[model samples]
Target: MSGEKLSLKDLARKRDLLAPGHRLCAGCGAAIVARLVMKATRGPTIVACATGCLEVATTIFPYTAWRVPWIHSAFENVASTASGIEAGLKALKRAGKLKYDHVDVIAFGGDGATYDIGFQAISGAFERGHDILYVLYDNEAYMNTGIQRSGGTPKYASTTTSPAGKVIPGKLELKKPISHIMVAHRIPYVATASPAYPLDLMRKVRRGLEVEGPAFIHILAPCPRGWRFDPRYTIEMARLAVQTCVFPLWEAENGKYKLTGVSRSIARNPKMKKPVEEYLKRQGRFRHLFTPENRHLVDEIQKIVDEEWNWLLKMCQLS
Candidate 1:
């Protein structure tokens, strides 16, 4: 809650609320993100997951990978459902009918659900000031539904819907600034995290849970299958995303922003930022952008990344 660093043993000692034996793809970043989030909580937690890769894979039929109480809600209503659950719990506590004094409620959704179809519900929950943590396991595209382009998909990344060809190169639209959107709601906590940095992610998760009102974490989860990369490069790709400033790790609390992890260092020294190409070249989804004809698209993507990084630094008052 205080941004205290957790030792490896400390993290290891925490119970794995999200158990193993699920059907997530090999090296799936969403699973890693969920596990880390579950490990960071201090007490009983109820998780509401939207219909996506995480929900479908973890709660298949009778078997479930979740060790804690979990609910599988509709794609566009995870936040709303979690809000209802929070309201119900509060009502029970008010009537002295609840056994537990404290319980953390969390909602898990993919980019398609959080950044696209579910945006309205998410925004409404934040506006209503629900005591819940909404985490977006953003693998960019809608990986669960055949790798379609979603609002979170980065520009110039090819997806099943946004195919690279003679016409449009890739997803021409820029990635939706979901974290900023959440910050605009003036919530207690808003953060962008990557599974590559588990400690930082855990710290943010802990901080979010400690807050009194709504909290949102946007995680840049890399998809090895959809990204067309080797399963082993999931963490590496996530690291590259942060190092390249493509996905800056930062948190906004009550409108005040602070860069974290490698992004904090990069904020102090912009020269330390890695090229966006380093992050893109590894993923096959952006492979076509490297072609001679499509080289401009890569430059365009770089420009957007730089603008966003600079703006983030400005928001944090780092520059």
Candidate 2:
């Protein structure tokens, strides 16, 4: 697809909607995801941002990073706030007072907000069929609050709340299947994406926005500080996540599953294996995963991921 129109590089060139001079960390995958999301949005888009790294980083004092119309709402209310915005826009359109022909509303929140505190509001928006896109940049914990464990934290991952102990290893429960829950809601569109694959992410973002009802794009953002990995390895870690089947790239439109991108070579070929250790060893969160008892936990994780991949691929085929 290199020389063809709408190539990956061409889509990647869609840039600078969120300008330079923003205060995100050097390897903040959330920043990359937000940039691509903004690029793919059609019509006049307004954003409702929740309290998190992105909000504090961008809207520091008089300095604002977003070029689009954006509002800062309470962390748990971003989805509700975006719904309000959509309603206002619809009211204006009906009254012939709206300046734009089509107005798109988006809500930005972290995993803490989406998977924990804000889940009910998000579900309400989905159930009510709001015309908006809610993007959850899943760094997998409450990074803004001292790396505390949130509902999205993976099984056996360490966090401030669920720290490694002689008795307790770390977060013990499996990461909540946020996307699958949304899919159960039967929203018109739902997707899992990553900043490492910008083209794929952008394509999914565009598709989500075009859907008539509520849509969601859950992005797996790797946090250098939270994960205890070198900032430079952010993109590499994200790519490995997909290659190892730890995070799959796929979408659902009108309840039809579609696996948009897959590292099939990694799945089919033996040489492509990168030990789950490689992905985990870099992260302090999984420090306990190296323990003898927890060593098998890593294998279990791999097994779960592989099984999910197989099931999802079959679902895609059936779709």
Candidate 3:
């Protein structure tokens, strides 16, 4: 995929490893992410998906959209399960009992499973240096379970667990810095991707998979029902996320960091970056922030975004 230009016609002609007919939402960014991710596999790939929208929808009853070997893992143990698979495959290959020469192992989990419930397991796998790539399709909440606020949820974004009202704002906490945490591990690769840029996302996936050691990609996926946006606006929302610096597109390879895609331009010229409100205004979850009384909350959130972006730029410059 190095020089291959990704277009609708070209992608349609390629064999999608995730296949079509999955029951994911019409504009679910996770589905698009999963499809593009699988297209970057270098060899026979095995996927271990945590119990979430991707696992539940893609594997209903006996029917499955996965055209490759797949495992349905419990929500909090996807990393552990993927680590076991990788270990088993290596053991078999060492004993000369396995037919396949190589198999790329990947673990899939939502934000709830990744940033919260499965955090410890993922940390263990990364520390152990397992040969696996963990793809986190973060829609910023536990959307599969009634849209409850997870650690990945942004501040003031209303969810079932954190409803905004005259009495209280939505979630009070900022999003967990999962990417930075993973980068601190000094892994082979750690990237933040968005479905808005398919080529960038696919290239990162390929890089993550091709790397020798543990790798992780945190993908910003948009959910139509959870975010209260039109189905057609999923890609638009993703693109705005980068342009607004609400979710920057970048990667850290072996403790070295660099901004990728449009984020690089935003770093050089701050004027090119759009206001964070441009991203927040698109989703109904952040609608209350537009109110006269709640307007200050938007400013507060913007301050955090600005600071985070500045910190990220400084971090990249250090390398």
- Could you estimate the TM-score for every candidate? 0.98, 0.93, 0.97
lDDT tens per residue, model 1, 1-319: 3657666578898778999999999999999999999998878789999999999999888999999899986999999999999999999999999899988999999999998999999999999999999999999998998999999988888999999878988888988899999999999999999999999999999999999999999998899989999999999999999999999999988879999989999978888999999989999999998889888878888898899988888888942
Selected candidate, larger TM-score, 1 vs 2 = 1
TM-score of 3: 0.97
| 77-108: candidate 3 lDDT, tens digit per residue | 99999999999999999999989988899999
Query: What C-alpha lDDT, on a 0 to 100 scale, does residue 186 get in candidate 2?
Result: 92
Give the whole-model CA lDDT for all candidates, comma-separated.
0.92, 0.84, 0.92
Q: Compared with the true structure, what per-residue lDDT tens digits does model 2 show for residues 1-319? A: 1111235655556556687799999998888778878878766789999999889898898989888889997989999999899999999999999988998898999999999999999999999999999999999988888899999998888888989888888888888989989999999999999788887887788877788889999999999988878889899889888767688888888888876665545545636656566788778888887878778888888887767777877877787
- Ranked candidates, highest lDDT first: 3, 1, 2
In what order do the candidates fall by TM-score, top score first?
Answer: 1, 3, 2
Q: Report how far residue 255 has shifted in candidate 3, in Å.
A: 0.9
Taking the candidates one at a time, how many backbone clashes does each contain?
0, 0, 0
Which sections of candidate 3 miss by over 4 Å?
A: 1-12
Q: How many residue-pair clashes does candidate 1 contain?
A: 0
* Candidate 1: residue pairs that collide: none
TM-score: the better of candidates 2 and 3: 3
